[model samples]
Target chain A: MRIEHELHARRRSRNVGLGLVLLAFVALIFALTVVKVRQGDLMEAYDHQPRVSLTPLDTPAGAPAEETPAGVPAEEAP
Target chain B: MTDINAYDASPEGEFRDYVALLKPRVMSLVVFTAFVGLWVAPGQVHPFIGFCAVLFIALGGGASGALNMWYDRDIDAVMNRTRSRPIPSGRVQESEALGLGIVLGTISVMMLGLVANWFAAGFLAFTIFFYAVVYTVWLKRSTPQNIVIGGAAGAFPPMIGWACATGGIGIESILMFMLIFVWTPPHFWALALFMKEDYHRAGVPMLTVTHGRRSTRRHILAYAVALAPFAIGLGLTSIGGPLYMAVSVVLNVAFLRGCWQIFRRSEDQAIADDYAVEKRVFRLSLYYLFLHFLALLVQSWLGGW
Candidate 1:
C-alpha cells in the first residue's frame, strides 16, 4: 500500500502549475506565429528586389529606386 | 512506524504561494487599464495578438510585483498589512521570488516584442525597470513623495497598451497615462491615512509617517484637485464620448467632495469616528478609478458597435 505524504501532494501541485504555464507559453507562441504568417504574402518584405508594381506611374524605366537596382524586370512584380 | 507529519515542520511552498508573490489583486488593475488603452487606441489589433499583448503586459506587471515583494520583504514582515505575504510568511524563499521575477520579466518582455511591436516591448521593459528598480529600490524608502513618483510606474501600462495597437504614442494615450498618475497619490494617501500604524511600525517613510495625518489629509486634497483636470481633460479627448464625460464629471464631483471632507475633519473628529469617513473615502476612490476606466471601455464599445 502506498502512503501519500502531504509534502508530496504539495510538490505535485506545484509541478502541475509550472507545467501548465509552460504549455500555455508554447500555445501562445504558436498562435502568434500563425497569425503573423497568415496575415500577408511571404515575399512582402523589402529585399532590394525591384518590382514594377511598387514604381510610380510617372517614373521612367531604369529609374533609381531605393533598395532596388535600376531597371529590374516588371515580370517579377506580384 | 515513521512519523508522517515530520515534513510539516518545514512546509513546502505551494503553487498558490508563487501566485501570491505575483500580487494578483494589483495585476487585475493593470490588466484592466491596459485593456482599455488597447481598445480605445485609434488602430486595430488582431484579436489574438491583442490577447497576447495584454497577457504579456500582465506578466510584466506580475514580475514587478514579485520583485517588489522580494525587496520589501524586510518591511513586509514588520507591517500588519504585508506580514502574511509569501516571502514574509515563510511559504516562499526570497531568492526563489527574485529568480521567478527575473525569469518572468525576461519572458514577458521578449514575447511582447515578438508578438507586438518592438516599441511596445521596450515600453514594457522600461515600466518593469521603473517599478522594480526605480520605485522599489530607490524611491520607496527614501522620501515622503515615494508614491507620487512611483505612481508613474503604474501609469505606464496603458501607454504600453496603446503602443501595442497603434505602434506609437499619442495624446490620447498620454491622457490615459495621466489619469492613473494623478489618481494614485490621493488613493494611496487615503490608504496611508488608515494604515498609518502599519507604516509607522514598519518604519517605511509613508507620507502619513513623515508629514503626519493632517498634512497627509491636506496632500490628499491637493492631489484630488490636481487629479480633476486630468480626469476631466481625458473626457474631452478623442477616446472620450458622452457616456465617459458624464461618468467622469459625476465621479470627479464625488471624489472632490470626499477629499474635502477628509481635508476638513479635525484630528479629534477622525479619532472619535475611528477614521470611518477616511475609510469610506478610500472605498469611494476605488470605485472612482474603476468606473472611470469602465466608462472609457463603454465609450469605445458604443463608438465601434
Candidate 2:
C-alpha cells in the first residue's frame, strides 16, 4: 500500500518544482494585494480612478519644469 | 449504479488533481507578468481593484491550462513528459478538466471585465480562446510553426495588464507584447531540442521533431539575434532606464553567445555532452525574461518610471 501511494504521489506531482513555483507566486500575489474590494468596486474605481498617471515622464534633457506634483508649489524643485 | 466523480477508473484522485489541471507553473508566469503590467503602467490602480484584476487574470490563465490539459490528454498520454498529468493518468477525468476550464474561464473573464475594464477583459477572453482553441486545437498538431505563431497567447498578459491600468494600449505595451512574442520561439525550441523524443512519440509536430536539430539550432540562433533589438528597444521606452539598458546589454550578449554555442554544435558533440549546452541555454531563457521584467519593476520602484 505504501509503495503504491509513493508511486501515485510521484506521478501526481510530476514536477513538484512547478508546484513550488506556483505556491511561491500565489504567496507573492497575496502579499502584494493589500486591499480587497468586498462589494465589487471595479466599475466605480475604473470609472473614476486612473491607476497610472497620464502625465508625461520627461521634458527634453534641459527643459524647465512646471506643475511639480511631487513638490510644494511654494518650495524649490528638488 | 454508478458514481459521477468516478469519471476515471482510478482512486478518484485528490484535491491536488484539480489544481494540477490548472498547470500552476504557467499560471505563475502569467500572474507575474500581469502584475508587472498593472504595476508599471502610467497610472495607479487602487490596491483592491489591482488585486481583483490580477486574480482574475491568474484564474483566466489557470482556466486555459485546464482546457489545454483536457484537450491534450490523448497526446499527453503518449508523451513521457506529460503522461503523468492528471487527465492522461486517469487520476482526474477529462470531463472534470473540461468543466473546470469552462467554469473558471467564464468567471475569470466576467470578473476581469467588472474589476478592470471591458477592453482588458476582452483581451483576457481572447487570450484564453487563442490558447485553448487557436494554439492548442488548431496549431499544435498541425504545424512546425505552432509556437512561433501561438506565442501570441503568452505575450498578451503584460498588454492586458497595461490595459487594466490605462484601459487602452500604447507603443510601450505593444513593445512589451513584441518582446514576449519574439522570445517564445527560441525558448521552447531549445527545450524541444532536448526533448524531441517526447514530442515525436506524442505526435506533436514540434519544430525539433519536424525540422532536424541542425535546422532548429539555426532557428534558435536567428531568433536570439532578432530578439535583441526589441528587448533593447523596450529598455529605451518610458519603462526603461540606465539599469534596464545595462541588464539588457549584458543579458543579450550572453543570450546570443548561448544560441551561438547551440547553433555551432554538431549532433556528435551535443550527444557527447548530453546536450549540456542546449540545456543550459534553455534554463537561461527563463532567467532572461524574468530579469528584464524584474529590472523594469525595480527601476519603477526606484522612481525611474
Q: Estimate each model's TM-score.
A: 0.89, 0.79
Displacement of the residue A58 alpha carbon in candidate 1, Å? 15
Stretches of candidate 2 above 4 Å error?
A1-78, B1-11
lDDT of 2 by residue, B87-156 (tens): 8777787788999899999988997886679999999999999999999999989999999988999899
i-RMS of candidate 2: 7.6
lDDT of 2 at A15: 65
lDDT of 1 at B198: 74
lDDT of 1 by residue, B1-305 (tens): 99777778664689999998888998999999998899899877899988999999999999999999999999999987788899988889889999999999999999998888899999999999999999999988888899999999999999999999999999889998989998999998887777666776666688887888889999999999999998988888888889999999999999999999999998899889888988999999999999999999999989732
Q: Give the TM-score of candidate 1.
A: 0.89
Tell me, by TM-score, which candidate is best.
1
Error of 1 at B123 (Å): 0.6
**Each candidate's DockQ score against the native complex?**
0.63, 0.07
Q: Write the per-residue lDDT of candidate 1 for residues A1-78, one digit (tens) a residue.
A: 998887888899899999998898888778777898887524255556656465555666677654444565545544
